[model samples]
Each structure stands twice: as structure tokens, then as C-alpha cells.
Target: MLRLHRLFAVFLLLAAALAAPAHAGKPYQYYAVGDPTDVVLPQPKKTSLVLMGGGPDVDAAFAWLIQKGGGGNFVVIRSRGTDAYNPYIYAMGGARSVETLVIPSREAANDPFVIERIRNAEELFIAGGDQSDYINFWQGTPVQAAIQELAGRRIPIGGTSAGLALMGRFGFAALNGSITSEAALADPFDKRMTLERGFLLLPELGSVITDAHFDTRDRLGRLVAFIARIVNDGWAGMARGIGVDVETALLVEDGKGTRVGAGSVTFLQSVGLPQVCQPKQPLTYLNLQGQRMSGGGSFDLRNWAGYGGATLPFTVSAEAGVLLTR
Candidate 1:
């Protein structure tokens, strides 16, 4: 009986171990590139964020990130992607050292050693991948807490593609799986239009939701739907949805956001409640404001005003479904 009980205990342990995330059993690898010197700062500065739309990276935004890092100790966090960023960050980020951490699971996210690296970095970058993996593995875990702590400390953080999707207070999450513009427009509350909240509560970004590969993917229609949901669901009386085009970057710093790279960044603000936003029914929204910002243009996030560009009015509905500027 004693032997049988011992065997049962061992089986239980094995099962528990197997049930852990895929990366739990595997070790986290840190790839280092370039000079491993320290770029020291006399004092910590306010936090800055670099939100990149999917596509080729922008050099101007990367240069800004490098400057914010104080020229050293840059870190890249990702669930999927190669260590190719190590060299790129080391060079473009102007860092004394660049390291990449591939954290693929919640268990890995809880690892104290991994958290230590995140906390020590002067600048942190989240790489592109499926944001769903990020939501499933990182949400409510120590990993999420650690990133939030970084933000609280005013550390600079940046991401591209899937990385950008996770920056806003409200995220699409893709929990029900990725949705297309046509599909989302057809039914505002389709299973695919999964929205999530409370993952990030960054100031000025708390009332904002983000979408990537905007123009290239024709995601404006869906982004409008997301804003309507935010208002209709009471997440915020007024919600902000930011859509970034391919190869573009929106740099948020000192309460201001600027657009750079080859494409434009569109800002969509819901004026009031949706005319129609029910499950299985088409969406109808009126008087939505949009601003198309290109490189060299800036906007005040705190005031929700545009300086270098114009904010145009757009009206979207189920029947006509046309994206117009007034």
C-alpha cells in the first residue's frame, strides 16, 4: 500500500508538471548582442511609449526609443519571433547592450529571474506576434504585473504589430479568434469582435483602444465598431480608438503623440452612444471624429486635439457603410 501511494504521488506530480504552459518546462533563453557596457543615468525620467503599426520598422521612432533608454540596457520581450532584434536594437537603439527574452508561457512569466531582467532594463520592447498568445499567457500573471510596474516607474516601452495591440487600456484580444473588417461590419457583436479590458491602465491611454495594420488591412471599419462598443458598454462615455498603418509609428511622450514612418495614424473618437450596436445586428454610428496624422504631425493626447493635422468627421452605418471625411 505504501509503495502504491508513493507511485500515485509521483504520477500526480508528473501530471501537474505537464499541465504547465509549454514554456514552463523549457528554460528561458536570453540572447545578448553588441557591447555589454552600462549606460548610466543620474535620475529616472518620465515614461514614454512607442506604438508601432505593423510593417517595416521606423528608424525615427527607434532612434527616439534609444535616446530614452539613455544609450544602454535595452530589452526585448516576445512570445514568438527570433533574436534578430538583439542586433537591431543594439545598433538602432544605441544601447550598450541589447537582450531578447522569449517568454512563451504564464509559468515563464512568473519566473523571478525573468521579472528581474524586465525590471532592470532601461528600455523594453515587445516584439510582434499573435496578441492572443500574449493575452492567454501573460494576462493576470506576474508577467503582466511586471510590465505594469515598468510603466509605473516611467520606463520606456515599445511594441510592433501584436505588441502594439496590447498597449491600450482596452484591447481586441482576439479571444474568439481574429475577425475581418467585412465580418465585423456585418455584425457588430459577432463572436470574432472580442473586446477585453483592465489589462493595461496607462494614463491618457486608459480610454483608448488600439488596432494595427490599419489602412493596409482596412481595419478602420472595425475600429469604429470597437469605439461604439466602448461607449455602448459603458467602458467610457467617450472612447478613443487609434489605428496605425503599416510601417508607421505613433510615439507617445510627455502627454503628446506623434506619427512617423511611411503611413498615417488615424484617431477615432466616439461622440456619443451608438445608434445600433447589438449582438447579431449591424452597427450604426453617427458623428465619429477621425484625424489622419502623418510624419512630422503631432497631437495632444491629454487635450484630444490635433496640432499638425486636421480632425475630420466620419459617419458609418450598416446600410451605406462608407468611411467619409467631413
Candidate 2:
């Protein structure tokens, strides 16, 4: 009788464990339909990065990413979502390889299986979600290190919206919360203007900061604020910013970037450190240059020069108040 009772207790526990949701007790939820072990080995190719603002991805841009993915073994990383992109990726026609992993916690982001998949992936895409979730969960984990390895191997990597937010050397990580232009211009040191760095250090994006949904969100003021912070904080000698509008993407390869989509991509270069940038004060900077690029336009990241578009020069100052002039 005693033996039977013990057996019954063990069976109940097993059943309870089996009934639990897959990936429960971990930091994230992971769902994959394809085999991660069956990925094709890495190949030497020009690594590319596609930075999409917030919107529906242009077909041409995704087509470009699909081609770069090589084979069907593409991987998508997100904080929360299903493998919905798999069908679309498979339709783009490679080896029919697509896998999606939603990592919700630091533990899940560092899971051996998750890290291994990321390392093996020929192409990786970061889905649009809360950038703060990304920073909080992925930073300082083996997952973050694995991404750096992928970049080192020259594999294709890209992201949309919040995912795109982290691709730059300096990121508006939104750790505290989203900042507004009014708050930022009012006080360049607003607590909401959280920034983070060192997630992925790609060469082409050195000294660069990125913003998404540029025009739609009217983020120019805030991006300027971010650039001000970078320079004032001694994060870089002078900071450069790229703001991509909705339905737009900047396809970057080598040291050059080409813009594509319906909206525009703006580049802002800080001539030098701000003359007057302090906590609780508006910014006063001279000769902050800017250029706007449309579809089929190109820009040299190394030189900050534009092709196929007018490289307009501009200045920003906050003597009495903030003023941007071309």
C-alpha cells in the first residue's frame, strides 16, 4: 500500500509538470516549429544590416533581407510573438528555413539552446517591440554575446522599430520610459531620455545613434536631444544620428547605406560639442548639419556625405529657445 501511494504521488507530479505551459518559469516564451540543429553552416559574405523605422516592411527591403539570409535557416528574435514571420520568410523562397524565438526574460535570452540557434543562424532579424524589454532582457547575457559573434562572422543582421533602435552604437534604450521632444528640449537631461550602448559594435555604425518612425512621431527634436547627450557626456567626439521614417529602411553594407521605402531617412551630424548643453537647460549648438535621403539615395557613413539627394546644411540653437534652420 505504501509503495502504491508513493507511485501515485510521483505520477501526479509528472502530470502537473507536463501540464505547465512550455517555457514557464523562465524569462521568456519560446516557440519554434523548425529544427535549430539543422541549420546550414556559416558562409563568408558581406554582412548587412537593415534598419526599418516603425511600419509595414517594404517588400523590396524584406526581399533583400531574404536573399541575404542564405538558405532557409533564418531566425527572428522577439520579446513576445509567434512564429508568424516564418510563413512570410518561407514564401520569399530560400531553403524554407525560418525560426522565431520570443525571449521574455534574461534567463531565456541566455539559454544554451537559444544562444546556439542565434550563433548558427545565417541571418537574424529582431522584431519590433518594446526596446526597453530588449535592453532589460538581453543585455549582459550570453545571448548578447552570441549576437556579437554573428556580427563578427559577417552574417546578415537587421531589425525593425525597437529592434532598429538597438542597432546603432548609441541607443535610446528607453530604460526609464519614452521621452518627448518637449521634455527633452526643455531639459536635455530629462530622466526619460535613457540611453544605452555596447550591445552590438558594428564598424560602419561607429559614433552613430539611430531613431525610428522619425517623421510620423516627430522625433527630430528628441533625436537632437540624444545627440546632445552623447556629445556632452563624452560618449563620442561628435555624434551622428540617423532617423528613418515609417515604411522606410536603410540598407547598410560595407560603409555605405542606401535608403528605400515610401518615407525619408535623415542624417544629422554634430559639428562639435554643444556650446551650451546642461541639465535643465535647452541646447545651443552651432552648425549641426543634416541631409535627407529618399528611395534609391545613398550615403557614405565614413564621410557623412550624401548621393542622389541635396545634402542640406543646417544649424540648431537654443539661445532664447530651440531653433533649427537650414
Models 1 onward score TM values of 0.87, 0.88
Off by over 4 Å in 2: 1-27, 33-37, 310-321
Instruction: Put down candidate 2 lDDT per residue, 1-326, tens digits, no spaces.
Output: 99999999999999998755456666655544454456565574676888899788766677787677666568889998676777777676664467778888887887887887788888888999899999989999988888888888877888899999998899999988888776887788888889987777976888889999999888888888888889889888888899999999888877778888898888898877878888877777666778888756578888888877634555555442365666
- Superposing every Cα of model 1 onto the true structure, what RMSD results? 8.3
Candidate 1 structure quality by residue, lDDT tens digits, 1-326: 99999999999999987654334445565667776455555335666899899889888887888787676788888987677887666676467788788888887788887787787778888889888888988899887888898788777889899888888999898888888877776787888888888787775688899999998888988898888888899988889988999899988887788888898888878888978778887777877877777657578888887876534435444443444445
What is the C-alpha local distance difference test score of each model?
A: 0.80, 0.80
Residue 144 displacement in candidate 2 (angstroms): 0.4
Positional deviation of 192 in candidate 2, in angstroms? Answer: 0.4
Please give the range of 10 consecutive residues that has the lowest summed lDDT in model 1: 316-325
